[model samples]
Every structure is written in C-alpha cells, then in structure tokens.
Target: MKLYPIEAGNFKLDGGAMFGVVPKSIWNRTNPADANNMIDLTARCLLIENGDRLILIDTGMGTKQSEKFFSYYYQWGDHSLDRSLKKYGFHRDDITDVFMTHLHFDHCGGSVQWNKDRTGYEPAFKNAIFWTNEAHWEWATKPNEREKASFLTENLLPMKESGQLRFITRNENNFIEKSELDFGILFVDGHTDKQMLPHITYQNKTLVFVADLLPTAGHIPLPYVMGYDTRPLLTLSEKAQFLETAVKNDYYLFMEHDAHNQICTLQTTEKGVRLKEIHTFDHLFD
Candidate 1:
C-alpha cells in the first residue's frame, strides 16, 4: 500500500478556539498567530492507494462557499484538492472511496462542489463512495445550534442525493472489508459524535490520523484540547487514553491541522507521553 499526503490548502482560525483552555503563551509558540490572533492551519488530507481502491480521508474546506463565507476563514496557499491529486498523477475520477473522519466543514467540505454554470452543486469525486457513520450522518443532518454553522447543507446533502453515500457502521469490525485500506477505526466522541480516526499500519509503521483529538504538535500535552470540541472534559479523557496507546504502540500521528508538522512520534517521559519528534510524510517513506 502507498500513502500520499494530499494538501487541500490552508486556512486560519482563532488560535484560542483551536486550543481550548490552553493559553496563547503556549500554542503561540508552535503556530505563531497573525495580527488578528488567527493561526494558519493546513487542511491536510490523506490518500491511500491499496489494491483496486483509492481512498481519501477528509476533503478539507471546499471552495464552494460564498465569498462572504470565505472572508471569515481565509483559505490561502497554492495547494488544493485537485492540484494535490494531479501531483500524484491522479484526478477526482481516480478516487474510489472518500472516508470522512467526520462531517465538519473543514474536514469534509471538499466532497461536493458547485457547478461551473452555477446551476447546482455536484459531487467533487464523481465515482467515489462517500463514507461516514450513520449516527454522525443523522446528527449533521439535524445539527444542533452550536454546530449548525459548521455542518452546511451545501457541504453535505449532495452525497446522499447522488446515491453514493454509504454508512461505515454496517460492519461488525467497524470497517468495510472490500475497502482493503485495512486500518483500525478509533472512534472518539468528545470532539464530535463518533468521529473515526484511522489507525493505519503501512510500510512498517503504525500511523494514526490525529484528527481534532490532537490537532497539532502543540496539542501534544494532554490539556491542550480544542474549544470547538462539544465536550471538553470528554476530550481530556480521550486524549489521555489515546496518547498512552500511541506511545505504547510507538505510533506515528498524522496531524491534519498542523501546517508545519505532518507526522509526530510519541515518547514516554517523566510527565507522560509527549511529543518525541516531528517529521514530514516523505521522511517516513524515505
């Protein structure tokens, strides 16, 4: 199996929001904030080429939002979903599965795109089966007040409308067999309901996609949970357990939001599991 780090571009969010109760003095050291206190974060997606299946995890914040909407997040950088795919000698049509960790806009927005003629929205990946959990699907569809803004209809609806939406919950093992991208699914609810993290074993390394549970290398310390998480305390417990497991297994965490650091290894220290080293995806294959 081959793994590709797909860059869907970069955007900025309030640093405080990204790092829950953590003080600016702490996170600012890692991802230095701009004048407005917004920190640049990469919407780094992952692509897995296993046998006949090509799976993409998380689509990044799509480009279909209104100008006013984009004015808020400020999506910048030359990297994009299309360009990154082409960089790997592939295109949208080449994708067979889109495994969404969750339906949050930044994570899954790129799944659908607006038509060129502006008639309506369409699936960005034409031939791909969009994978998400049934419970999260229901929650996103009927979102609560706090999350309603993040779960936009334009970012969703079309997948199901296109008859390509499939729930990942039908499997007893919590994975699809034919989706030979064999990986253990680590589900965490503190950030969002049933958010799945792919614990992937590839090329002699055990890698875990550290979704919002661990957004950046700065989030290594257990208390660095994000304010956006629905339940902050639950996140604390999840992080403690996951960090322990990651260190115990000597796993390489594939960070999604961190712009500079792509992968990191956990180490056991007197304080407990802490950030051991930061490296890029290419460094791993090399």
Candidate 2:
C-alpha cells in the first residue's frame, strides 16, 4: 500500500476558536496568530493506494461556496484538491472510495460540486462512493443549532442525491480492527458525533489520521481542546485515553488541520503526553 499526503488547501481561523479556553499567551507559542488573530490552517487530506482501491480520507473545502461565505474563513493558498491529485498522477475520477471523518464544511465540502451548467449540484467524484457513518450522516443532515453553520447542505445532499453515499458499519468499541475501507478506524465523539479517525498500517508503521481530535501540534497539551467541540469535557477524557494509547504504540499522527506540521509522535512527559517529534511525509514515508 502507498500513502500520499494531499494538500487540498489552506485557510485561516480564529486562534481562540481553535484552542478553546487555552490562553493565546500559551497557544500562540506553538500556533502563532496573525494581526487579525487568525492562525494558518490547511485541509491536509490523505490518499491511500491499496491494490485496486484508491481511497481519499477527506475532501477539504471546495470552491463552490460564494465569495462572501469563503471570506469568513480567509482562505489563502494555490493548493487545490484537483491540483494535488494531479501531483500524484491521479484524478478525482480514479478515487473509488471517499472516507469522510465527519461532514463539517471544511472536511467534506469538496465531495460535491456545481455541475457544468451551474443549474444544480453533483457529486465531485462521480465514480467514488462517499463514506460516512450512519450516526454522523443523521447528525450532519439534521444538525443542531450550534453546529448547523458548519454542516452545509451544498456540501452534502448531493452525494446522497447522486446515489454514491454509503455508511461504514461502526463497532461498539472505540476502535474497529478492520473497516470496509480495509483499515482500522478509531471512532471518537469528543470533537463530533462518531468522528472516524483512520488508522493505517503502512511500511511497518501505524499512522493515524488525527482529525479534529488534535487539530494542531499545539493542541497536544491536553487542555487545549477546540472550542468548536460540542462536548469539551468529554473531549478531555477521550484525548487522554487516545494519547496514552498513541504513546504506548509509538504511532505516527498524520495531522489534518495543521498547516506547518504534517506528522507528529507523542511521548509521555511529566505534564502528560507531549510532542515527541515532527516529520514531513516524504522524510518518513519516502
């Protein structure tokens, strides 16, 4: 199996929102903010080429949204999903499966796009089966008031309407040994309901796609959970358990939102689990 780090795009978000309750004086040391207080972030999706299947983890924010809507996020960068795919000598049509961690706009927005005529929306990857868990599918479709803004109909519905949407069978435990995508999944709920974190074993190493559970390297300090999380208290407990397991197994964390740091590993410290090392995808995988 071969894995590629796909740079979908980059954007800025409020540092305060990214690190909830954690003072800027602290988080700023790792994720420094701009004059406007927005910190750099990227939609670092993952692509796995396993035998006949070409699976993409997340789609990132697409370009279908209006300028006004995008202005809020302050997107900046030339990197795009199509361009990134072409970099690997592939295209969207080649993707057989699209495994979405969650249905947040920034994570799965690129799954659908405006048709050529601009008359209606359609699945971005026409030949791919868009994957999301049943619980998360329901949660995102009928979102609560707090998360409603993040779950846009334009980013969803089209996948279902196109008849390419499917759900992964989730197990009762926190981790699934093997999923239909042929990889392990760590089901976490602290960030969102039933967020599926892919645990891929490649090149004799376990690399986990650390989605929102740990957005940036700065968030490794336990208390620096995102304010966007619905259940902050639950996040604390979940993170503690996951961090402990990550340290024990010496797993490599593939960060999805961090713009600067691509991969990281944790080490047990007096303060708890802390950043052990940072690596580029090429340095470790290539």
**Best TM-score goes to which candidate?**
2
The C-alpha RMSD of each candidate to the native structure, in angstroms, is 1.9, 0.6
State how far residue 245 of model 2 sits from its true place (Å): 0.2
Q: Could you give candidate 2's per-residue lDDT for residues 1-286 as a string of tens digits? A: 9999999999999999999999999999999999999999999999999999999999999889999999999999899999999999999999999999999999999999999999999999988999999999999999999999999998989999888999999777878999999999988898889999999999999999999999999999889999999999999999999999999999999999999999999999888899999999999987
> Candidate 1: where is the Cα deviation over 4 Å?
170-181
Compared with the true structure, what per-residue lDDT tens digits does model 1 show for residues 50-99? Answer: 89999999999988888998899977778898999999999989999999
lDDT of each: 0.88, 0.95
Kindly report which residue stretches of model 2 are placed more than 4 angstroms away from their true locations once superposed.
none
TM-score of each: 0.95, 0.99
Displacement of residue 278 (Cα, Å) in model 1 is 0.7
* Backbone clash numbers for all candidates listed: 1, 0
